[model samples]
Target: MKTDSQLQQDVMAELRWEPAVHATQIGVEVEDGVVTLAGEVSSHVEKWNAERAAQRVNGIRGLAVELEVKLGALDKRTDVDIAQSARNILSWTGSLPEDAVKVLVEQGWLTLSGEVEWQFQREDAAESLRSLPGLTGVSNQIGIKPSPSATVVKAEIEATLRRSAAADAKAIGVEVHGTSVTLTGAVHSWAERDSATRSAWGSPGVRKVIDKMSLVY
Candidate 1:
């Protein structure tokens, strides 16, 4: 097992390796296995990429991002313009339903609220708005509309996990209560853990997925 300092170095190196990130401007700190990213970037996309780069590193049990988006003068768009751009992008997104997402902008921060039939739709909406110029942050308040029938949530989730080819599918426990799922197990890497969580969320009628799984390495 790598020590906390070793893990911290690995994460810093990973950040530097990512082309989208300005690694020198970002500060990385590790305690135990948790990573905290602190600094300011020129764009929201850079901040998001930095977080993803850190999460890709092994031994990262948790991540707390304190990075801020410090937009330049040319990148600064009015709140009205940001809202229009957000709406336009959501409209152009083929996966999302028209008029399903409601946008509210305040001081360059955007908040999206609405209900979608699936989790992917909710995610897609936020992703479409993440790279918008002049945006300081995004809050995805969109929720999933529960299916009328949840009789087979547990079975379906298990089947999906198995189909995903997760390394420890059998070891992962799936517990369903109402439309919520709680996953418990130990995986060898972050990829397996994310796969298991996505499988749970993909299952129909799953409004919430609580990932209690941990990394064995």
Candidate 2:
């Protein structure tokens, strides 16, 4: 006693696909929306794709992820192989020091650990890994340290920000305790807060910049 349209809507909601997508692949039946998918995709990842795609169809009371995982299409690389490939990309790019950063991939989730000479490099490492497929999230614990020539870097960051925020250099407190810079002060607007942080990074000697600026609205 189920309607065709009702079943279709259920599967679609489960996946949160676009309206246009629902309109296209909605295959309805008298009993339920029996979604039958066919294809030859690369790996087990795509095997899940078939199920997930059918799942988002709306009224899928039952699903058949019967699609075969075409191993021939895949390189037969283990998860560790993909993880090493991901690490190599980050290391070869010198996003962080080699061995200083560790990459671990499990079921497509990329985890990174390491120390870098700059906040930029730490961030770069995390970003590069995020681009890999099947990433759930990144645990970026990369520590940053000031370069030997960070004084110039700090000065440059400050100069660039001063163009926007009317920051009294004295009002902005800067404390360099290791590889991180603690910024304890206040800025007028959100824009000023961002500008101030950018200035801090421009300074070559700084590593990470933490701001304690509360918006005064």
Candidate 3:
């Protein structure tokens, strides 16, 4: 296991290596395995990139992001403009159905609410606006429409986990309650844990995923 100081250093180095994040404009602090990022970035994309870069560090167990977005004069846009642009972008995204997502922009923050059949579609709706100028943050409340039959959701998740190429697939346990799924197990790395969760979400009718899985490293 890496000490907190060592983990902090590795995270800092990762932030530097990531081209999207301005490492010098961000502060890193570690306690136990939790990393706290504080500072400011020029765009919402930079803040998101910094968070992703920190998560790529192996020993990081959690993140507390206090980074602020300071938009420049040219990057600033009215809430109405941002909302219109978001709507146009979502409409242009082939993966998302037209009018499937509702956008609300307030003080440069965008909140998305709607329903889709697949988890990937919900993700695609949010990813479509990550780099939009004048955006501060995004709250994706887009839901996955539950399957008609909940009885087979658990079984389908189990089959996928067993069939997936993930090395720890068999070690993970699946539990279903209505449209929600709970995954419990231990994996060798963050990658395996994420893969296991993704497999669970791939099932039909899984509106919420409770990941109880942990990293063994």
Each candidate's number of clashing pairs is 0, 20, 0
**Tens digits of lDDT, candidate 3, 26-56:** 9999998999999999999999999989988
Tell me, what's the RMSD of every candidate? 1.2, 13.0, 1.2
Model 2 C-alpha lDDT per residue in residues 1-217, reported as the tens digit of each score = 2355665555445433532232233332324445454444444444454455555442334455444434452345566876877777876775566678887766555677766676677767866764455444456776665455445554555566556444645556665555466677765544555567766765554656788754342
Off by over 4 Å in 3: none
TM-score, ranked from best to worst: 1, 3, 2
Q: State the lDDT of candidate 1 residue by residue for 28-83, as single tens digits.
A: 88888889999999998899999889989988888999998999999999999999
**Could you tell me how far off, in angstroms, the CA of residue 84 lies in candidate 2 after the best superposition?**
2.3
- Evaluated against the true structure, the overall lDDT of model 2 is 0.56
* TM-scores for candidates 1 onward, in order: 0.96, 0.50, 0.96
What lDDT, from 0 to 1, does candidate 1 have?
A: 0.89
Q: What's the ranking of the predictions by lDDT, best on top?
A: 3, 1, 2
What does the lDDT read for residue 62 in candidate 1?
A: 85
Candidate lDDT values, in order: 0.89, 0.56, 0.90
Candidate 2 TM-score to native: 0.50
Better of 1 and 2 by lDDT: 1
